[model samples]
Structure formats: C-alpha cells, structure tokens
Target: MALKSPRFASNAALQNAARSAPPIRRGANGQHVAAIQQAFIDLGLGMAISTKKAGKADGIFGGETESRVWQFQARMGLTRDGIVGRDTMAKLDELLPTAGPPPKPLPPAKMTHKINVHMRSIDNPTVPEFTQLKVMEEIYAQYLIRVDVLTGQSVGLTPGEQFTLNIVDGDCKWDQVSDEQRLLQNSGSNQGVGVNDIVVYFATVLREKNGETLQGCAGHAPTRPAVMIAASATDKTTMAHEVCHVLLSSSFTPVHVGEDANLMCSAPMCTGQPAYLSVAQLNRVFASKLLHKL
Candidate 1:
C-alpha cells in the first residue's frame, strides 16, 4: 500500500528544489541513487538512505529524495523539511570536498563468465506495482501446492499447517531487517546447509493501466511470508501468487553446486552465482514463478 495525499505542500516547491538539486534515487534497484546518497555520506551529512515510498506513482523528487534531504536537514538543524536549501548546499561544500567529478559508478554486477541471453534487468520497471494484497494469501497457498508437487517435501501446501503463518507489511531489508523482517526477507540470511527456506511468487495481472500481467507479488521467506500487491489486484489472485512461492521454497532441497542450495527464488542480477543460484546443475532447484508469470 502507498500514501494517497500529496506529502509535500506544493509540487512547485518540490520542483524548484529538485531543479536546483535533483533528489538522489537509492535502493537495491537504483544503484545510481545509492551512489548519490553515498555523496551525502562523503559530505558528512548524517545517514542518507532510500525510503520505501514508491517512485512510480508520486515522483522520485517528493518521496525518498525528500526523506533523505529532510534527514540531512535534521542533522544540520535546519527545519526538517526534505528541501536542500542554500545552507544545506553550503554544508555539503564544507563536509565533502568535491571529489574529482563523481567517480563513475560500477554497473550492477552480473555472473557473466559465460552467459545465456535470457537475463533481464532485475531493477527494470515492474509493471502494475500495486494490487489488493489481501489476495496474495491465496497465491502463496497455491505456490505451496506447486512446490509440493515439484519437490515432494513434507510441508503444508493445504489449508492446515504445522507452523504458524503470518503476513505483514514492510521491507524485508537484510540490513535493517528487524527480528520480524529477518523472518520474511530471504536474502543474506541463515537457511540450513541445503535449504532455500524462501521463495517469491508473483501473479500475472494483465492490468490495463500499466499493461502489467502481475496482480501482486509476495515472498515466502524463512521467518515470515510476505505479500505485496500490484495496483488493482484481485483478492484471490494476489493470495495465490505468494502462496505458490512459499510452497516452492519449502519443497526445494539443495544438493549443493558450489557451497549453497541448488534452488533460489530471487533472480540473481549480479556477478555472483551463489549469491542467488548455484554452479552445479543437478544440485540446483530453481523456481520459475517470475519466469512463468512473465
């Protein structure tokens, strides 16, 4: 879900501030944004990071950029509005000396010793970014069914289950992952020697507005399973998407390619194979939910 009201007083004020200095986009998807925030770090402005505010609907300027700028202002004791005024600019000059024209940022790392052309942008714009998250519960359930049929593992894919299930909202941020978040986010976590412990199930929505085929998206992680809805997603479809992935995750068993599980749900858009997938062929068990949805 996202905020409905315009968080800023006027788009003009936001526009003027952005024209002077554009808001830096930062996130796992937007490396350029991260690098720009790093510039603030270099400037000794307090911590500057991306907020979960969606950039597509509202605009990048008024969302994370403003949030980060406001943080900078707070650290500088300027009114905590996300506008980077002259004082903030001066502070930037004082703290971080102009590094010789911002160093070119390294591109998103990829595992390309030898490559297949099937790879796509992990950070590319996802279509239909919002839906009725309430439905993802069913998606997750169906995902579980798929996994059981595929893997034959002893986990619940039906209405009854041994483990308690929960669905919550918030980022499963590996770094800032709270005890609760740790349970939901799969990346950078402790899954046994040969277990995936997580899966991401995405449903195709075929949305007219965004031309997106996905109704919603959700993750079946080690500690918690999460549901994220795409715009206007129906209740049943949303739930089914996420449920499918959860079942998949629980069903997979790792045979060990290099040193990790054979299957991975999060597509590795990076240089490291084990970061998401394994090196060995038989040892791997990959989920094609996103692939199938696409």
Candidate 2:
C-alpha cells in the first residue's frame, strides 16, 4: 500500500494535536501520529523517522516511528516506552517554540533599591561594573523593583588589600567577623554608601587561608551589609547573587539551593542566565530595609 504524506491545516493545528492528543504508539495512523512525527522533525529528529526518504513524515506509526519515540524519550530522560504519553508530550511541548504573540512587557517598577560600588584600583573584572549593574536591574525588574547606582568609584588599596583579600579559614560566616572583611567595610573604603544603600567591592582575588579561591562573599561585620566580588568570578550573575545574599542576610537559613536555575545557588554551579529568585526569595527581598518605595 502506498503511504499518504502527513498533512495538517496549519502549524498551529499540528501544535494543538501534539499538545492535546491522546497517547499514541506503534500501529497508530492519522493526523495525530503525523503531528508527533512532525514535531520530532521540527525538533531536528527527522533522521530517525525519515526511512523512505529525507523529510518524509508519512501519517503512519511503524517501526521507524516507534524507534524515533524511544530516541526522544531517552534524550528527555523520560521512560523509553516508545509511546507518546503525557510526560513525553509535555517535554516535546516545552522544547518546541510556541506559535503565538510575543510576551507582554512588565509594568513600571513600584519599588527601588540602591547599590554603591567600589572597585580596587588594580582589579579588572571580566564583566564591567556598569554591565553587571544592568544585569541586576533586569533580574530585579521582574518583581517590579528597580536597582539604582548610588555611587561607583575606584579606590586605591594598600599593599595588604591589593590583588587578594585573604579570608580567614575561607569561612563565610555572617556572624563571625573576618579581619579583612571588617577592615574593608569600616576603613572608609565604602565612602558615599548610605545606610540604605548596599555596598559592593570589586577585588582582584578573594583567597582563603587554605589556598582556595572564592568568587564572592556577603560576609560583613554586624549591621554593616557588604558584598565582595572577585575579578575572576564576575560573571553576569555573580553580583546579583552576592547582593541577594546581603538582602537575604544571615537569618535566612539554607542559604544555598540545589537548583542551578536559582540565584541563591552557589557560584560555579548556577548556570541560569540572569538566575531567577523564587517566590520565597522575593518575599525576603521585599522585606529587606534597603528596598524603598519609588
């Protein structure tokens, strides 16, 4: 029997079928099967289904289609049952681009926070301070909050404070004060930082007593909020992460989360572009004294 080419009224129709259709397996034949096959092809999995010829997606679920389903399931870490069930369908929907209007822009900011930046004279960060501030603005904007730069300056460091700020024991305990951190925060280096403004210092290195290098830290003397960022660790998201630490404060237990998508995830592991803050984290951020009405 000659096979009929898969057909759909439109891409939206195909997407609808792929999303709402019931489970499909081998022996199935029609537009629903075709939708799934087409979705695979759309996701660059056409080679598995194109047995007869390239780009050929017949409205038939045979051995080739079943094999394709298995391959997709494995790739998505779903059960390799060769059936397009709810889980498999959901994964496909997530990967496929939506066919619809663009998302609406967020409304104006309702609240604002300020940051005071101080960079060591010898430090050269990979991500510039201005660019880092912009990234922070974008991340906080989701909560209708605006981040403003209160001040930015380059401070000359003494022989001891230059290049690397030695952290005692490499411990970032908020309650325990490290001499380096205390000196840096109280040594007038954070000049121009108001009580309500968060202070950020960019240093070339943040080395621990044990020879380990840290990307950044939020540890400071009691009642003094500050963030220290290492030049080597200044990715687009590091500043936000450290500032979030100060906002969250030592009272927030379980400071680090396991999910890489979260902003609180420890550095070198968090990979989310502009990592997101959870609802719980947002609540804490709003409660911080640094946040003020616009």
Candidate 3:
C-alpha cells in the first residue's frame, strides 16, 4: 500500500520539518511538498516543476515534483535520484531566502514584428564580427525594435553577389543608390527573405568615383526593401544607423537633420562621432508598422 504524507500543524512546523525531514519519495503528499516546491521556486530553479499542473504548490510528491527535485539535485551537484532525502532537504534549507519571497517579473511587452535578417559575406563567405546578437543589442538599446536572423548561418556570397556602389567624388554616395537597384544587384542565393523582412549584405569593397572609400550605406524599397552595409563599418552604431534608415525613412527623402549631435548626423555635419535619432525621429520609428509599442 502507498504511504500517505504526514501533515504539519502550520508553515512554521513545515519549515521546521524541512530542516530535519526524512526522505520524501514519490507518492507522498502533504504540506511538506508544497513548502519544498515553493523553496525551489524562490531559489531561481523553477524549470523543474510545471507550476501550471502542480497548481499553487499542491501537497503531492508525485512524478512532477519528484522530477523537479531530481533537477535541483543535478544542478546542486548532488545525486540525481528522484528522491528528496535528508541531504537534499538540508541543501534546500541552506539555499532558501531568509527574507521575503522573490520579486515577480513584469510581463514582457508584445512584439509587433520580428525583423528577419539574412547575413551574407563576400568571397570568403565569412560572417562579420557584428553578429545577430550584437545587432539585436544595438537596435533594442535605442529603439523598441524586434529583430532576429532567419537562420543561424553565415551564407557565402558568390563572385556576382556584391554591394552595388555608385561612383561619386568628394561625397558619400549612400543616397545615390536606390533600394530597388540595391536589392536586384545583390539578390544572389537570397531565396529565404520574407515579404516583411530585409537582407543585410556584407561586401568586399565600396569605393567612389575618385576611389574615396565610404564607411557604410543603406536604402529603403517600399516595393522591395533591403539594407547593404559595408564590412568596413564594423561598429554596432553604424549598423544601427543604416537599419534606422531602412525602417524609418520618410518617403525616400533625407530624414537626417544635420547640425545636431545625433545618430542621424554624420561627421563634419555633427560635432560628435556616433550620433542618435531625435525625438521627432523616435516618434516616426514608434509610429512605423515595423515596431510594436507598449
């Protein structure tokens, strides 16, 4: 016959029992299991138990609770048995907070859109130092943007797949190139870009008419959109700048307001190195369909 759990008079009694409690094997049920489960949750090892199924620390030492205890044992470098014996209970007692319960986490805001990026490299087919994680970090640091990579691969660019640069002298030809031309020219082996997603290609070289090198450039295609960043533009802020252009462009017109120390303003025009978007620019980004707001 299965053994029934021993009941306690109160929580103080349960906690006191937990300090010197005996082995809590499967099939046992009582306030002891509830106390142990709550202790597990408070210690930041919550994945062990299915809270939804267990429901407010049900006083049952069943398979689920046993499994949770086993996980806790494994994490604590103890025996992996599915039993909470004297040693396990002692460890739990040692780790349990002496103060109040753990603070509840705030619910994350709903993500409006997920920007799927296709990272392509030139000749050697090498992914840049600026990875998807770094990209997410940069964009999310400033704007409330939700971006992710399509697949976890540094796709190789064939001989033909190169960023098309406009030949201009004494100035950056970033705006001279159209989004349509940029997409069509670099549309090599890019069969995974979704309708709402964008492609970011890292090219070998991007020079002007007089061989003047540019840091990076980007354009937006309302019909077919993509952003081509120079591999030389290694900084995260540069990537953020180009991406901002793609998502927050106003009717293909220059939204970059010069004379301000912001991300939109570049060198010579602005008094700083890396800049940021203005309040108006932020409003534009927040209003865009690409971003999900709180």
**Maximum-TM-score candidate:** 2
User: For model 1, what is the C-alpha lDDT against the true structure?
Assistant: 0.31
Question: In candidate 1, what are the lDDT values of residues 94-170, reduced to their tens digit?
Answer: 44434443233322222211101111111112332222122332222211212111111112222321121133233
Query: Model 2 scores what on Cα lDDT?
Result: 0.63
Task: Show pairs that collide, candidate 2.
Answer: none
Q: Which residue pairs in candidate 3 collide?
A: 262-275, 262-276, 263-275, 263-276
List the candidates ranked by lDDT, beginning with the highest: 2, 3, 1
Top model by lDDT, which number? 2
Which lDDT tens digits does candidate 2 get at residues 1-294?
A: 111222333434334434545467767787667777876666655433333454466768765566567656655667766777667766655554353321332222344444444443236677887777788776676445667776666766676765335332345668555676666666556666667677787766677777788888788766667787877775678888888888887898679877665678754756555456655566677688877766
Q: If scored against the real structure, what TM-score would every candidate get? A: 0.22, 0.59, 0.47
Per-prediction tally of clashes: 40, 0, 4
Stretches > 4 Å off in candidate 3: 1-113, 123-127, 131-136, 152-185, 220-222, 250-254, 257-261, 268-276, 292-294
Residue lDDT tens for model 3, 198-280? 56655555555567665555643464455555555544455556667766754544556553445565552332222334444
Distance from true position, residue 138, model 1, in Å? 27
Return the number of clashes found in candidate 3: 4
> RMSDs, each prediction?
19.2, 12.1, 17.5
Better of 2 and 3 by TM-score: 2
